[model samples]
Structures are given as structure tokens and as C-alpha cells.
Target: MTRYVMVADLRRCVGCQTCTAACKHANATPPGVQWRRVLDMEIGEYPDVRRAFVPVGCMHCADPPCMEVCPSTATRQRDDGIVTIDYDLCIGCAYCAVACPYQARYKVETPRFAYGEAPTESEAQRHEAGRIGVSTKCTFCVDRIDSGVEQGLTPGEDPEATPACVNSCIAKALHFGDLDDPDSNVSQLLAENQHFRMHEELGTGPGFYYLWDRA
Candidate 1:
């Protein structure tokens, strides 16, 4: 079976949050909820310390902790190791959210909607609820991937054509591809660079890797 993975170069990430913005726009998340968030942290002594921005989203782990603890089996791993929530099946219990080692799951209030026109309270409420009554988050733009497949380009080859984050990345720090393909950039990046997964001790076996190091 073929599997795909996502990898990122932390060194190249500028923390501009183009990924975050693109995700919000694509997913149409209301103001309070964020499917993709760039977490910033500052550590060490002021003179010698550094600041880092780590973009947080579904890690799509092989041994997903969220899956193990889900009571309703709302969360499941995809064939390619992508983790997703079944909106119709989700009971809004937030058990999966509590179980995720990466804290990736979100249990937010169903937000109101807003169309391109100016927002009234009722219109805003309806428009905001794009997909109501479910655990919500990034699907790694699976819809986009499917769409790209309809076109000529392979999933990872079409940056703008596949994922919103990839399209928004001015630095091209984030990469998406089939990990099984040795020729793919995602695979080559992993082989060539020293990458680290966040919260590795938890044993979630995240598919995503970050390249943050001293060169």
C-alpha cells in the first residue's frame, strides 16, 4: 500500500503564518477557531536564547493517541496515515481532544457564518457553521488532493493545486508528497536533513518532521 507524509523545514519557516491564514481561508474557520496555528516559543537566557515558531496541525501519526482514547471511534487514521474526524459520527465529547499528545484536536462551539456581503447576526451565524456539530480541523486539504488528482499533476507536485498551506508558503518551507516515493522532495528532505518530530516521547509516531538545527 502506498502512503503519503508531510515534512517541514523549521529553519526556513519565517513565522509569517501564511500557512495559518491560508488554512483559515480555505477551511472558512470562524475567528475563534484555528485549524492550523503557529506556536511561538522563546527559550534559554536572553543573550544566547532563540525564538521558534512551530506550526501546529494534525500530525497524522501512525499510532495516534487520539484514536486510542476515542470512545466513539470518531477519529481514525487514513490509509496514508492521515488522521481525520468523522463529523457525522462525532458526539462532541472532546475525548479525542484530551487524548491527543500533540493537542491537535479542537472542540469548539459551532460558529455563525459570514458571506462575502456584510454580516448580519443571523447571516453570520448561518454562514459560520460550515460544518457544524463535529470535531473540526485541517484535512491536509484532502479535497484539494483529490481535485489535483483529477488534473494532470500528482498530489505533491502541484503546490498551489494541492494544499492551501503549500500555496501560501512564500519561503516554500512546508512540503507535501508521497513518502514512499524516494524521488519525492518530502522523502529526500527526510533522508538528507536532521529532522525532529514534536513531542516525540509521546510515541504518536507523527508523519510530519521539522528541520530546526544549527548549521
Candidate 2:
């Protein structure tokens, strides 16, 4: 029972948004669609104000409301705890989008380019026709994980198997690994840090963890 999870260290995040750019480049998402994004927050009063950059996306929860509400059954969770969307089976009703508490889901009705009318060569080449009008979100780069595993690589330890966002973090604030493994990187981080998951009271059991302070 491998449960994949990501941890974001708030103390280290510098709000650079390199992870956001890497996600867009890797997924080739439309102009307005962002699968990975960092939220900037001003904490405390004006005199004691401090900025925090929180990276957010699909939590790939232990109990996903999006999965329960998908009429077309396009949203599916893998045995390894990776949530995936079958574009071929997706009907694009936006049901799953509404059910997602993390606001990670995106449904684009038409092709959109970075430019006004014309798509650059890279955008055109990477554009996914099947993704149009479908509920799409982060899969923690499952393709890379699966492919790397097939090639005898450890996901979190190997750069080739890790998620693009974690690899691209300029501040090294993001981490990904199997939560079920006590020896994993994420597990160790959680054990040594004071952390919280967003909206945990909703009972979504989100896999994304935010480390705020040392334990």
C-alpha cells in the first residue's frame, strides 16, 4: 500500500513560482489553466506583516469528493494513491470540478494559446486535444513515476521519477514521496516538523502537507 504525498515547507518558500512555470511547461496547460500555483498571503497585522507563498494543487485525497461526484467516472484513484482522469471517458459536465475543495480542477472548453490567436510551435506540438472540455488536475506526474519505476528507479530519490514541481522548486520547499513508508523523505519531514493539511476538517484526507515550523 504505497501512498504518495507531497510536503511544502513554508519556512523555506520564497514565492519564486518556478514550480508554477515548470508545471505549465511540463503539462502544456492552456493560457488560463494552472495545474500548479503558489498563493501569496499576508500574515499578521500591518506592523508585523510577513508574506508567505503556499504552493497549492490537487491533494489526491484519501477520500476524494470529486471521485464520488463524477457522473462519467473519468476520475479514478490508483492503488498507489495517485488520482487520474481518463480523458476518453470524461463527459466534461464539471461535476468533479465543483466537488473539488482544493480548486485544482480545470475544464477548458476550447484550445487556448499563450499568444492572442496563434499558438507557438511548442504549444501547438504539446497541445492535448483530449483535454479540452475535460476535468483535468495534477496527477503528481504519475507518468514519470511509473516510467521511472519500470526502469528500476526510486520515485522520490530519483530526479527522473520525482514530480516536476518538487524538482523545480528554487527554494527546495516542496517534497514528494510515499507516505506509507516510514523511511521516506516526506515521512521524515512530517515526523520532524509541525505541519497542517488544508481544510482537514472537511474530511477529504488531503495528501498535501504544509510544514510551518519545527516540532
- Pairs of residues at least 3 apart in sequence or in different chains that clash in candidate 2: none
Model 2, 1-215: lDDT tens digits are 79999999999999898999999988888888889999999989979998999999999999999999998888999998889999999999999989989999999998999887788999889988999988899989999999999999878889899999999998889999999999999999999999999999999999999999999
Clashes of 1: 6
lDDT of 1 by residue, 29-141 (tens): 76666777888878799698988877778888889888888788878887877778777778888877777776776766654444544666654544644356667767888
RMSD of each: 3.1, 0.8
Q: What shift in Å separates residue 103 of candidate 2 from its native position after superposition?
A: 0.6
Provide the lDDT at 71 for model 2: 89
TM-score of each: 0.88, 0.98
Question: Number of the top candidate by lDDT?
Answer: 2
State in Å the error of residue 41, model 1. Answer: 1.6
Look at candidate 1 and tell me the lDDT of residue 46.
68
